[model samples]
Target: MKYDSLARDIIRHVGGKENVIDVVHCVTRLRFRLKDEGKADTERLKAMDGVVTVIQSGGQYQVVIGNQVAEVYDAVLEAGGFGNAVSQEEKPEQKGGLMSRLIDIVSGLFTPVLGVLAATGMIKGLTGMLAALGILSTASGTYQLLYIIGDSMFYFLPMYLGFTAAKKFKLNEFVGMTIGACLVYPSLTAIMAGEPLFKVMEGTILQSPVHLKFLGLPVLLMRYSSSVIPVIIAVYFAARLQNRIKKILPDVVKGFLTPCITLLIIVPATFLVIGPVATWMSQIVGAVTMAIYGLSPMAAGFLLGGTWQLLVMFGLHWGMAPVGLNNLVTYGYDAVTVLKSATPIVTACVVLAVALRTKDKKMKGICWPACISSLFGVSEPSIYGVTLPLKRPFIITLLCSALGGVIMGAFQTKAFMAGGMGIFSIPSYINPETGIDGSLYGYLLAIVISGGLGFILTWFFGLSPEKKEDSASSSASDIVINSPLRGRVIPLDQVEDEAFSCGVMGMGAAVIPSEGRVHAPVDGVVTALFPTLHAIGITSDEGVEILIHIGMDTVKLNGDGFKAHAAQGDRVRKGQLLVEFDMEKIKQAGYSLTTPVIISNTPAYQAVTVLAQTGDGAGTENGAKISCEDGLLCISTC
Candidate 1:
C-alpha cells in the first residue's frame, strides 16, 4: 500500500468517512461527493505527496492522483469503508444544476466497465490493424475468433448498460443484468428479423412485425442489443416498479413476488412500449445530431473542440458521452466524439514544447510521461501535471486542438468504433468497407495540425519566469529533543499508530499527556499546522522537522477541542505555549490524547533516540513537576 498513507491522508483531509457522501473515480481523479465541501482541506490535499491537485467541480470534490487513481480509490474505500456509498442516494444539497447531476449519473454508470470497454475496443482496433496490414485475413478463423472477442462487448452492450443503470438507480445489480441478458437474448433478435409471430394493425409500425403478444396486446419487437437509451430507461422504470411492488406485497412473499411481478411487467413493457419508444427517441437524437454536425461542420468542430476541455474542467463532458454513444448505435459511426481526437494529440505536443522550453528539471522529467500518456489518449497527466497549472499553455492547447477539430469537421471525419485514444484510435477511424477513407486521412491531418500548432504556440509563450533551483544542504551532530507536553514518555514501538510504531512515517515516540497544553520542545520555527489544529510541525534551528500530534486520529475532531497558540512559521523558544486543548472535551468527544511527538525527518539523522529520563516530567510525577523545558530525545546527524 504505497498509497495507503496518501489514501488515509486524503480521507482525513476530505472531512473523514463521516463527511463523505459517496466516492467514485475515472482515469486520473477520485471524485468524492462530500457532505460538506467546507470541511475539506484543499491546501493540505494539494501539498500532500502523491496528490497531483484538487478540484471542486460539478458538485464533485475531485482529488487528482494521476494514473494511480484506481488503486487509491480502492484504498480509500478500504480505509473509509464507503462501498455502500456506491448505491446511496445523492444528497439534495450537493449543489450544481441538472448538468452536474447528469455527469454524476453517467460517470457512475460507465466508470465501472470503461476499463474493459477500452481493452476490448483496443483489441478491436488491433484486429482492424492486423487485417489492414494483411497479417490476418478477414476470412481466417483466428480473425473471426478475435473479432468475436472484440465485438462481444458492443453486441451485448444493453446488458452492461442495464447492470450499471440498476446500480446507479439503487436497484439490484444482478436483477439489472438479468434484464440486460433478456434484452440481448439470441432468439429475440432472430425472431424480430425473421418474422412476427402474428401481424399487427397495418402501418402501425414501419417494419410490420409483432414477434410476441401478451394476452391481446401486440408486443412490439425491435433489436435491443447494442442499444443504450432503452435499457437505461427500462431499468429506471424497473427500479420504480420494483419499489412499488415491494411496498404492496407482504413481507414473506415480497422477495419472490416483487421480482416476479416487476420483471414480468417490466420486460414486456420494455419490449412492447419502452424499447420501441426509446428506440424512436434514439432516431430523433440521431437526426438532431446529424443536424448539428451538418450545421457547418468546421464551426461545430471549432466550438466543441475549443470548449470540450472547459466542459471537462466543469465535468460536463459526461453530458456529451451519451450523445456520442447514441450516435454510434444509431448511425453505425460517430462524428461527435471522433472530433475529440485533436485534444489529446495537442496535449502531447504542448507538453513536448514545454519540456523543451522549461529549465525546471523536475518539470522536464514530468513532461515525458505526460506526453506519452496523452499520445495514448489519457489526457489527465498532460492536463493536470503540465498544461492546466500553467494557465496559458492549457488555453493555447485547447485553441490549437480546436483548430484541428475545425479541419476534421471540414473533411467530415467520423469513427466507427471506440478504442484507446490518440494515435491508437486510428484503426477506429478506418472505414470498414473501404479500408481507409477520407475519415482516416482527414483525422490524421487533424492530429498533425493540432500537434504542430500546439507545439508552436506553447514553445513561444507558455512558460512563466524560471525559478531558482533549490540547492540547500545540511549536516549536523548529536542533538537532544525535549518533551513537548507534560506527559509520561513511552517507547516509539509501543505507540498505537502503526505508521509511527512500525517506523513508516518516521522514528517516533509517544506521550500519554497529563496536561492539555503543548509547548515547544526546542528553539525552532513552526513549519506546519494541521487545519484541525490537532497537530503542529516545527523545524528546529538544527534542521529537524518535528511533528507534535495532539492525539490519535484527532483530525476527526475538526478542531473542536484544540487551539493553536503558535502560528505556522513563528519562531518560538523551548517551553513556550504552542497549543492549548480541552482534555475533558477530547474525552467527551471519545478521543484519547496519547499524543505522538516524532522527528518526521528522522531518516535524515544517523540515529534518533528517546532520552532516558528520571521521574517528574510534565506533571506526571509523584512529587515534582517538569515542563517541556525537559529533554525527551537525542539525534546524531548523518
Candidate 2:
C-alpha cells in the first residue's frame, strides 16, 4: 500500500511531515492534528483521485478515502517513518490539556482492540439471554465452556489496557504488563481478603498502636487486587521512575536493584495511598450516577441510550466502560441498562429498513448478509450500507431506540447479571432466583417497540433512488487533444517507473514524456499553479479543468528545479509549453516523475472510461480515452 509515501506526501501537502503533531484514522478518513493549519493545501488534495472528500471539522484535518483507507494509511506510515516521529509525543506543550491528553490516551489504548472488544461484548450478551430463556442451563457443560470464551478477554482487561497505555505513554509495555500482572495476581487477591498486615504507629508499621506519637498521625494499611485507577497511576509513575533510576544507579547492581526499589516504593504507595483514594473517587462517581438514575430513570436511559451510538462514533464510548465494570464489581448491576437494549434494537431497525428500501438487485443481495451481521451486533455494515445512505432511517432508528430506553428506565428494569446488550442480552436481564417474571417483561417490551417502530417508520418513509440507464450515443467524441508533450505516444502506465500503476490515476490517464516539460493539452487559461511548480490547473475551452501533478510529494521541494512557463490567468493553446522542469535534476534529487492528469470537474461528467487497453485489434495511444464504461457519470435524460 506504500502508506509511508502516502503519509509523507499528505503531510507535506498539509504543511510538512514536521508540521503534523499526530495522525490517526477512523473507518474512512485519516485524521491529523497539525501544528499549523494555515500551511495546508486543501483544495489541491480535494482534486486528487481516490479521494472521496476533504473535511476540516472538530479541530481535525480529515481526508476521506472510502474503503481503501487502510491501504492509504499504510502508505502514509511508510513515508513518515516509524515510531514517535509523527506521533503526539512530538507536541508536549499540548499534553497539559486534560481532555486532549485523555482523548489521546484512550484512542491509543482502545482503537486497536475495538473490533475484538465489541465482538466479545456481543457474545457475552447473547450467552446471558440463552441462559435466561432456559435454552442453556448455567450448570450445563456447554454454558460453562462458552462462559470462558466471552469472559476471559474482560477478566484480563487491565492486562490488555496496560499494554496499550504503555504504548500511548511511550513506556516499555513489558514493564507495564509486569505491574499489571502483580495487581491481578491470585496471591495479592488472597492477601487482600485477609486482615491488615500491621498496625500503624507514628508513620511506621508496628505490632501495637501505643507508640503512635509522631505528629499525632497513624500509619495506613496496604491492599491490592481488582483495583483500577491506582495501578494505572502507579505504572505511569513507575515508567518515569524506571527511566530516572537507570541513569543514576551503578551499572553493577542497577538491573536487579532498580526493579526491587521500584516495586518496594510503588507497590506500597499504590496500596496504601493511591488505591484507597482511587477507590474512594470511583465510589463518588458511582454515587453520582446512582443519584442520576434515581432521580429520573427514564431520562437517564433516554440520554445514555440515544447517545451511545454517537459516543461510539467519536470513539469516546470507552470512557463509560470502566463505569459499567465498576458497577458490576461494586453493586453487581449497572444502572445504565440502555447500553445493552439500545444497540441491538437500533441495529435491527437499520437492517430491516435497508432490506425494505433498497431496490438495486446487487444491493438487495448484499443487504441479507448485512442484516444477519446486525443481529449479531456488528452494525458497521448496516450503518454504512443501509442507515447512513438512507439518512431518514438512521434518524428514525435513533428516535425509536430513545423511546424504548425511556420505557425500560421507567420500569426500573435492571439486569440481574452483568453482560452485554442485543437480543442475546435477554439472559442478563433475567433474575434466575425469581424466574423471568420480574422486569423481564419490560426488557422484552423495549426491544419489540424500538425495533418495530424503527422498521415501520423507515418502511413507510424511505425510498431508494432508481438507477438511470446510460445513453449509448453519448460517447467520447467531444475530447480533442493536442500533445501535452512532444515525446512518442507511449502507454501512460508504461512511462518508465511511475507513481500510479500504469498512467491510470483514479479515472484518467496521463502523458509521460522523455522530458519533464509540460505543454498545454488544450486551449485554456491557467486557473491555478501550485507554489511548488509541480502541479498546474487549466480550464479548457470545453470547460474541463485538467489538473497535472508532476510527482508525489514534489510540493515538499517547494518549487526547486522547476520553472513555471505561464502565470495564473494566462490563456494557453494546445501544445503551448506551460511548465519546464529539469528531469535529471529532479531524479538526482530523489523525486518521482509519474504525473497525474485528472479531470477536476468529475461530477459534471456523465462518465469516465480508459480506452488505452487493447484486446484483439486496437492500436494503443500515449493516453487513454475518458468516457463511461457503464453510463455517464452524471446525466439528464429526456
Candidate 3:
C-alpha cells in the first residue's frame, strides 16, 4: 500500500507488463530491464506523482522511489502477474561486454542483503561502544549475549552469500547452502588442525596444504567462516552441474536426484579444486590492495574515498567485497573499512544543507527524512530523494569524503571489526585489544572534517543548477486519468447496461477488456470494495470520485472468478493493480466482458474527454488499444 500506485504507474509507463524484461529494486529505486526504453514516456513519468526522478543508467531504467522501493517492487510483482518476484535476478543480455555482465551479477547478488548487513554492522558497532564505555564487560553475560548477536551475521556470511549465489546462478538454494556448510564444517576445522599429510609448493597459491583428500587428491583446507568467494564459485559450478543432471534424469527422480548427483560432483570439486583456487585468488586480491596502500596510504585513501560512493551508484562496490573480507580474514583488520566509513556521514551533512536551503516545502519534507536515514548508514534515500535531485549537493559530499579520507589515511586507519557506515560505526575503528587507539581518534577527526566541509560548502553553493520549480504544483494542477484495462475503448452510451450507458451512474468511457484484469486509473484512496467484487470505488486525491463496474450485471457471479488484491479505504495510484478475474468465466456465465470506468461525480466536472480511435483501420475494435500509458479520458473543470 505504501507505493501501490507508484509501483503500478511505473510498471505501465515503462511500457507495461509486456515490455519489461525484468524488474529489481535497490534501496531507493526500481531498476527495470525493459525490452525497449523507447516505449516508455519519460517526460510523463518525470512529471508523475510520487516519482523522485526517472534515471536511465547502468543498463537499467531506474525509477527513483525514495525509501519505500521494496514495497513498490512487491506491487509491481502483483501488477505484472509475478508471485515471489525476487527469486533469480534477470540475466543481462550476453551481447554486452564482460564488465557490464559482471557488474550485473555482483550487484544483483549483493543488493537484497545489503540492508541487513548494514543493520548487523551497526549493532556490532554499538555493542563495541558499550564495552568501550565500561557499561558492559568481556565477562558479563549481557555483553556476551549481545556480542554473539552482533557477530552471528558476519560469522555466517558464507551461508547468506551461498543462498544469493545459488539464486543468481539459478541453482537450488538448499544445495548451495549445503556446499557453504561443508566449507565451514567443524569436521574440516578439526582435520586442518592436525597436520598436512602432503603440501603444495611453499610460496605460491595453496602454500600450506592439508592432509585431507577428496577422492584421493589432496584437499587444501582453509577457514571458511566469514568467507565470500569460495562459496560463490562452488555454487556457480553447482548450478551448471545441476542443469546438466536434469537433462539425463527421468521425470520421476528429477527433483531429488538432481540434488543428489549435483552435490556429489560439486562437493568434491569444491573441496579439491574451486575452494583453493578462489581462496588463493582472494588472497592475491587482498595482498594487491595492501600493496597499493603501502605505497602511500593517504593517496590510496583519497582515491577510494572520493570514488567509493560513485562506484556504489554504478554497483561497482561489490568488486571490493572479497578484497575487504580477505583482508579481515588474513590480518584481523582492514584499511578499506576505515577508508569508506565516513561516506554516509558526509552524505547526511549535505542533505542537511539542502533541507536548510530549499524554499519548496515539498522538497524540505523530502530532505529531512532522507538526512536522518543517512545517519543510520542508508544513503540512497538522501542521494536520490534529496541530493541527487538537487544535483549540486552530490558534488559537495564527494569532495568532503575525499578530504575525510586524507585525514583518516594520515592516521593509518584500520577497522578491527565489521560495521556499518556513519558515526555509529566509530567503535569499529577502535582497536579491540588497546581500545580507543590513534586510529579511532583519526576516524573522529575525519568525520568532523567530512561533516563540517559538507555543511559549509553545500550551505553556500548547493542550490541546484537546474531551474527550480515546485513539482507538487504540477500534481495539483493536472488530473490525467489513464486507462484501467488493456481493452478497446467504446463510448459509455453504447454499453448495453442502461445504468452505465444512459448516464444514470455517471459520464465516462467503457472498455471491453482484451485481458482479465482491472487497474486503477488515478491516484486515490479506495472508497469502497463491493462484497460481490464486481465493482470498486476510488476517490482521487484531487476530489474526483470514480466507480469501475466490471461486466454487465456480473454481480450475480458473486466473486467466483474475480480476485481482489486491494480493499476499502486503501489509497492507490494510477495503473496500480486492483483486481483480477477470469474473463472466459464471465463470458461462459453469459455476461459481457465490457467494463465501465465512470467518474461518479460527472456534473462536478466542466468536461470529460476520451481519445477517439486514431489508428490505420478506421472504426475497428482492435485498431487502437487503450492502456494505462494512453489516456482513457481527461477530467476537466471550467
lDDT of each: 0.71, 0.58, 0.71
Cα-lDDT of candidate 2: 0.58
- Model 2 residue 572 CA deviation (Å) reads 32
lDDT per residue as tens, model 3, 300-388: 67867787676554333544676678778999988764676788889889988878865545557667766765776657556645665
Q: Write the per-residue lDDT of candidate 2 for residues 1-638, one digit (tens) a residue.
A: 54555556676788877777777654346777788888888987777766666778657787776435656776776677534323211222222356445434443355455555545545655666677677999899998877777656555655666666666555556666666676566665455445654443334212222211224433332233323344467678877887788889999988588777777776555555544343344344334444667788887777666765554443334345566777767877665744347566666776667676654343465466556556655454455445544456666767777878787887777776764445656677776677775467878888788788778777776542322222364433445334454333334465442333332333355544467778887666666665567777777655666767675546545678888777554556767788888888778778766665656555566644433433323434633332212111222111
Q: Candidate 1: lDDT over CA atoms?
A: 0.71
Scanning candidate 1 in windows of ten residues, the lowest lDDT window is 87-96
Each prediction's TM-score versus the true structure? 0.47, 0.46, 0.50
Give the best candidate by TM-score: 3
**Residue-level error in angstroms, candidate 3, position 314:** 16
Please give, for residues 533-626, the per-residue lDDT of candidate 1 as tens digits: 7777777766777888787656556678777776553557777898889999988877778877788777788888766566644332232333
Candidates 1 and 3 compared: the better one by TM-score is 3
Whole-model lDDT, model 3: 0.71
Better of 1 and 2 by lDDT: 1
**Candidate 3 wrongly placed segments (more than 4 Å):** 1-122, 164-170, 186-201, 204-211, 221-233, 302-404, 410-442, 448-638
**Candidate 1: misplaced stretches above 4 Å?**
1-115, 157-170, 191-251, 265-281, 289-295, 300-405, 411-441, 451-587, 593-638
